[model samples]
Target: MDFVDLEPEIPDSIQVSRDIVYKETDQRSLKLDIYKDEFLVEPAPVIIFIHGGSWTTGGKEDYLIYCLAYAQKGYVTASLSYRFSQEAIFPAAVEDIICGIRWIKAHASEYGIDSSKVALVGGSAGGHLAMLAAYTADESYFASGCDENAVSTAVQAIVNIYGPSDLTTDFAVAQGATPKFMGATYDVNPDIYKVASPITYITPDDPPTLTLHGTIDKIVPITQSDFLDKALITNDVIHEYHRLKGWSHTMDASVPVNEYAQKVMTRFFNEWLNGDD
Candidate 1:
C-alpha cells in the first residue's frame, strides 16, 4: 500500500471539548475535544482518540492535526486530556476517559454523532485506557457520572497504537528504562502497578481490536503487545496487529521510518470505525 502524509488545514465544522473532572484531586479540567467533518444532514459515528506521551506529558494539541484529518473523513473525532500520575494515580486517568465518553453521548446530536457507535484509538498510556474502557469490570467505573449504567462507555472497537499491553514484564525495569507513567517496577509498588494494568481485566467480551508496535521499540517494549495479543487469541477476540521493522522509539513523527506505522494505524481505525472490515 502506498502511504501518504496528511496535509495541514484548519477545519470548518463546529468543535468543542467539554471539561469534566472525575476526581477532586484530578482538579484540572479533563476535557474531550470534538472535531467535526461537517454540519451534516445526518450525524455520523464518533472516534474518541487518546494521545500518547507515556501518560505523563501529552495534550490535545498533539492530536490537533489528527483531529482535523479524521474529521475530514466524516467521523466526529475527539482528542482528550487526562490527568497524569503526577496529579493523581491509577484509575484516575481511566475514570477521566469514562467521563469524556459520557459527555460525548450526552451531546452527540449537537456534534452530529451516533452515540451507540463510538470507537477508541489511543497511543501509549492512552492505549491502556482504551483497552480497559472496553474490557474492564463494567461496573468498576467510579460511578461519578450520569450514566448509572456501568457499561455505557463500552467502545465498539479499540485501536491501541503501540500501548503497553502487559504491565507485568520486567525488561524495562531490569534495563533501568526511564520511568514513564508506571514509573517504578511492580515490586516497588505492587498494588498501584496492578491497578494500572489493562490485562488485569481482559476477557473474551472485549471489542474487536487493532494493535501496532515497532519491533525495535524499547520504551515500552513490543513484548507487552505480544502478551496482550496472546491473551486475545486465548479468549477468541477479533483483532489485527502490525509490527514495523527498523523503527525505534519514534523520535520524529515526520521521518520516513515511522511512515509505515502511521499508515497502518489509520487504516486499522478506518476499517473498524467505518465498519468496512
Candidate 2:
C-alpha cells in the first residue's frame, strides 16, 4: 500500500472533515478537517495546527500526524492550509486562517468545538501566522467585502515552534529569510515585511505563549525566540520558553524533546485549555 493512497478510516466516534462555512476567495474556498470523539454531546476545545515550510512550501495535509496526535488527546483538531507566498502574500494566508476560525465559531454547536477555548499551534512560518491570529486585533487587516465580523482572529494560547519573530536583523544570516518570502525589502514593499514579523504586534492583551527553540537552528535563530520571550515577559504577558540545547532548527524532529520538554508542553496545554486536565 502506498502512503498517498492510505486513508485514515477513523472510527465513527471521530469526524474526519466538513464543508466551507466561509471563504476568502470564491475560487479559493478554505477547507477544514474535523477530528472529534463525538458530535452530539458536550462541545470541546479545538486545536488548529498550521504547518510550516517558510510560508512558501507546505500545505495542511503535511500535518496529519500532528492533527491526530491532538485529537486523540480529546480535542477537535483541524489541520488547515492557507495561500502560500507565490500565490498570495501576507494577509491572504492570514485571512484564510481567520475565515477558518470564524467557520468554527459560526458552526460551533454542530461541530462540538468550543469557540472560546481555542489555541493556535504552528511551526516556523505557520507559527508567525498563529501569533498574528492571536495578537492582531485590528478589524481592517482583512478584506471586508464579505461578512466583516466572521474572523475572530483571536486565540487563547500560542505555541511557537522555532518561529522567526524578527524581520530586521543586523546579523547577516536571518536577514535574507524575509526577502525570500516577502520579496525585496528596499523595494516598494516595506509594509509587507513589517506585517510578516510577529514581533511588531506584541501587546499586553496578547494571549499567553509557549515557545520551543533550538540553539543551533540555521533557518531561524534561537535569538528569535529569545526576543519574543523577553517581549512577552516585559509586557507581563504569560509565556514559557524552552531551549533545546545542542539541537538545530528542526529540533522537534532531530532532537528529543526529552521527558521534561514533553511534560512542560503537555501541562501548558492541559492547564490552559482544560481547566483541570
Candidate 3:
C-alpha cells in the first residue's frame, strides 16, 4: 500500500469540539475532544482514542489525526485526557478512562452517537487502560468515583496498539516504568500489578478486540500482545492481532504503518461496531 500523509487537514464536513471537561478531581479536571459529522440523520458509532506516553505523558491531542480521519468516515470520534502516573497511580488512569466513556454515553444524543456501539482505541499505556476499562465494565471496583454509575462503561470493540497486557510478566517487572506507574515494586504489591493487567480479566463475553504490535518493540515488548492473544484465544473472545515486521514501538507514527493500521482498524470496527449483532 502507498504511504499516507500524517498531517492531513480536517475537512469542513466534520465538526470539532476541543477541551470539554468529562470529569473533575480534587487535583484537576479531565477533558476530551469530540469530532463528528455535523449533519448526521442517525446516531453514529463512537471511537474514543487514548494516547501513549508510558502512563506519564502524552495528551488527548496525540490522536488528532486518527480522530479526524475516523470522523470523516462517519464515526463520532473522541480523544480524552486522564490522570498521568506522575499524579496518580494504578487504577487512576483506568478510572478516568471509564469516566470518559460514561460522559460520552451520557451526552450521546447531543453528539448523535450510538451509545451501545462505542469502541475504545489506545496505544501503549493508553491501550492498557482501554483494555482494562472494557474488560472490567461489569466490575464495580473501578467504578467507585465515577458520576454516571447507572450508565455502563461497556464497549462493543477495542483496538490496542503496542500496549502492555501482562503487568506481572518478567519483562514488566524488570521495567522501571511499570513500577513507577504502579507506585510499588512488583514484589511489594504483586496483587495490584495482577489487578492492573488487562489480560487478567479476559472472558468469552468480552468485546471484540483488535491488537497491533510491532515485532521489535522494546519499550513494551511484543510478548505483551502475545500473552493477550493467547488469553483471548483461551477464552474464545473474538479478536484479531497484527504483528508488524521490522517495526518498533509507536510504529504508527510512521506514515506507512499508520496507513496500514487505519485500514485494518476501519475493517475491524466495521465488522464489530457497525455490523449486525
Decreasing lDDT order of the candidates: 3, 2, 1
The CA-based lDDT of model 2 is what? 0.71
Which pairs of residues have clashing backbones in candidate 2? none
Q: In model 3, which regions exceed 4 Å deviation? A: 1-8, 275-277
Candidate 3 lDDT trough over 10 residues, lowest sum: 1-10
Backbone clashes in each candidate structure, one number apiece? Answer: 1, 0, 0
Report the C-alpha displacement of residue 266, candidate 2, in angstroms. Answer: 2.2
Q: What is the C-alpha lDDT of each candidate?
A: 0.68, 0.71, 0.90
In order, what is each prediction's RMSD in angstroms? 3.8, 3.9, 2.1
lDDT by residue for model 2 over 1-277, one digit each (tens)? 1122123456667657754436656447666677776543677788888888887877777656556556766787887777776776556777777766766777777778888888888888888878876777545655534353654657788888888887665441245545666655535666666666677888898888999888988888888889888889888999989887877765564314533444565688887888223
* Residue 134 miss distance in model 2 (angstroms): 0.9
Better of 1 and 2 by lDDT: 2
Tens digit of per-residue lDDT, candidate 3, span 39-136: 76789999999998999999888888999888888899999999988898877899999999999999999899999999999999999999999999
Model 1: ten consecutive residues of lowest lDDT: 17-26
Winner of 2 and 3 under TM-score:
3
Positional deviation of 233 in candidate 2, in angstroms?
Answer: 1.2
